[model samples]
Target: MLSRVAPWLASRNENGLGVRVLGGADTLALRALANEDAVANVFILAHLESTGTAAPTSGGASVFGVFDGDTLLGACWAGANLVPVQLEPGLAGYVANAAHQTGRRYASIFGPAETVLALYSRFEQLGHLAHEVRADQPLLSISGGPAIGANPDLSFGSMADFDRILPACAAMFEEEVGYSPFLGGQEFYSKRVAGLIRQGHSLVHIDAQGTVIFKAELGAVTRDVTQVQGVWMNPELRGRGQSAGYMAAVVNLSRTFAPVTSLYVNDYNTKARATYERVGFEQVGTFATVLF
Candidate 1:
């Protein structure tokens, strides 16, 4: 594990700018930096609040920081996916270079549009190409009650609905990522869905025949915001006018955990975008994703 992070530890530029693995002592500074844009940095903030700044002993994930002297300027969550937080566009190349030196293969890189794309550009220069680049995802959020009526049928999922919900989740993942999430094994993905259900993070509207009508998960959450993901409506039900109500219900239900509800949608998803707008969400920023 030390060897995995050694390159970052030893790298420092002439201008006092450097990238290194963050430790527990850096928690306060890191949290402060993430708070600069709570909605955009909610994922890292949630992780920090839950897990602190210590890197995992298994070498699975670690927070890397960019600093000038002792001041924290930006950071990146180097794990299954690289998530940049408050990373300045000009400094992205440094972070990407350090990440490349670690020889870690990330599944994706995602976050604010400018930072993600800048980081991806540096990665591309390092010969780390992406399978796809979604460069214009709108990051939408809502802080008050939704504009439409809530769906009466939508409810938080439970273990009893797991059988139906898991397939819908997998379908959404496959549709979005261009591969089945179950390709490696079902256990990991199954546990993830089950955990979200158990934690009351999974929301769904299952029909009488046990078919999922609509589903979405609060993938990243904090007291201030909940980032929605894996949102899906049954293919058979897509053309109906029910999406707005269902999404309104999602916003209403999600507020129980956090005041602000947020989710990013691909620029090409006009229907979802329209439904979200109808439900009262407004674009706060742009996000980008580089799928590996």
Candidate 2:
């Protein structure tokens, strides 16, 4: 089990942590809090920067939190993504109830493992199944650049290669997410993949026949860090000593966008973790994902 929840931000006065919706004026404090652990907070910070408000009233979602006087102890984003960051058990329970009360739909709940588990337990008790729960996934981050030789085969994918790469992308999504991105509809997810391709975020390694051998993407980006996700290798290519070096190539490629590259892997996945370690990723934290 993770350590007991800390009192860093949740209790600073006789009043204790006060829970409420964060407003636009809280933006500066939010950024400062996010900067404490840039890699872990990148998604929230990026969303905040994009929307200019902690709680965007225009359509996405809102940020609710537990604050100690004026210091933010932890916060939860109840938006399209449904993320919680650095939340302790008490704060997490509060946020979980808040999410239920608001009745907003979200895709996933992922962040620090303990907080995620805490929040998910509350949500589950409230009748949400959280169909798939990935607990104890190691969150890894690499600063600077790749420490090993890059795979000569890798390249940034492009719009022109969309049709060629779409199948590979779909395969990776299903394999990792346990469901096809096209489950609800193809157009939205297709456009999302295409948008990443247009931004030169998709990295691919192809064979002589032009079939994708391995592929991944810079899935999320912030000023100081970018997260690499959707990593997949051809089944035929597995256990061939090729993955680590290929991941090195991906990390080096990702450096063009941000100095740090981050990703999380299942704790049970020894092979993938080994590949990432061999390629220079260090476990900085742990993440959990409650997939509904």
Candidate 3:
């Protein structure tokens, strides 16, 4: 049986390691655990806290844990996306045993620095490929850019717009999230879009042709920060640099509600990454997503 660790953030030693789900009130503590510079849990905790969804299955969900036998080590929860664990040195055996016990197959994994190589080698021994390298680059804005201007027909979308927006929204989800919202359903997708609209964070750009050609939505928002998400341009217009301008415009527009803006991109996506850099986003850190 796995040892149960208390969920209190303040109770952690930064030296004791185990995995347990902290209840709702304990989220702040989880946030504290993430703030530790040495082992900041990024996507795992952010999604857990933001979306309040956590399920551990071979092909879904994400889970995180702290390893405290010596130094406090925080690892990202890739769930069943990759085998065993995303970050490791301590407890690879434990992760493997757990996955085995549950009959799950972890196809591959990713992590930061040498830690990734070590885990990769172990998974290779377990018969999975260390075949690819992936990086989740975190981006934050630094210095100059106008907050708001050139308001190009900005307006909040109503539910009435869903019929028209569904196709593009679903496409954005597939491209950015790596999954289709249909599998998750329309309600979840609609709620997500509505939330952004309510916050005045979803924007669309239409050309003189009256075609809705560009769109971007907020994934996360706070008093000081708004994350650009679901960014897309109609496929027919892919060759043009329309996305970059819309991104800048979104940043400019969102600043009215939030002061700092940030987002993440897959490292292999050099095109989108370059566009973000051109519009003034600086790489602040890295993150990863493990797909089973």
Choose 2 or 3, whichever is better by lDDT. Answer: 2
Higher-TM-score candidate among 1 and 2? Answer: 1
lDDT tens readout by residue for model 2, 1-292:
3234433233433466577888988887777777788888888877766677676667657888778777888887777666886667666767877788878766789988888877777777778787788988999999987778989889999887888788899998888888898987899889988988987889998778888899998888876898988899998889899998889999888888888999999999999999999989999999998898
Whole-model lDDT for model 2 versus the true structure? 0.82
Superposition error at 181 for model 2 (Å): 1.4
lDDT order, best first, reads 1, 2, 3
Candidate numbers, best TM-score first, in rank order: 1, 2, 3
Query: Model 2: which residue pairs collide?
Result: none
Q: Model 1 Cα displacement at 181 (Å)?
A: 0.3
Q: Among these predicted structures, which one has the highest lDDT?
A: 1
Candidate 1 residue-wise lDDT, 1-292, digit = tens: 1112223223457768988988888889999999999999999988876776645536568888998999999999898899999998677777898789989999999999888888888787678888999989999999989998999899999999899999999999998999999987899899999999998999999888889999999999899999999999899988988889989999999999999999999999999999999999999999999999
Q: Please list the residue runs of candidate 1 whose C-alpha ends up more than 4 Å from where it truly belongs after superposition.
A: 1-12, 57-59
TM-score of 1: 0.94
Q: Considering every candidate listed, which one attains the maximal TM-score? A: 1
**Residue pairs with backbone overlap in model 1:** none
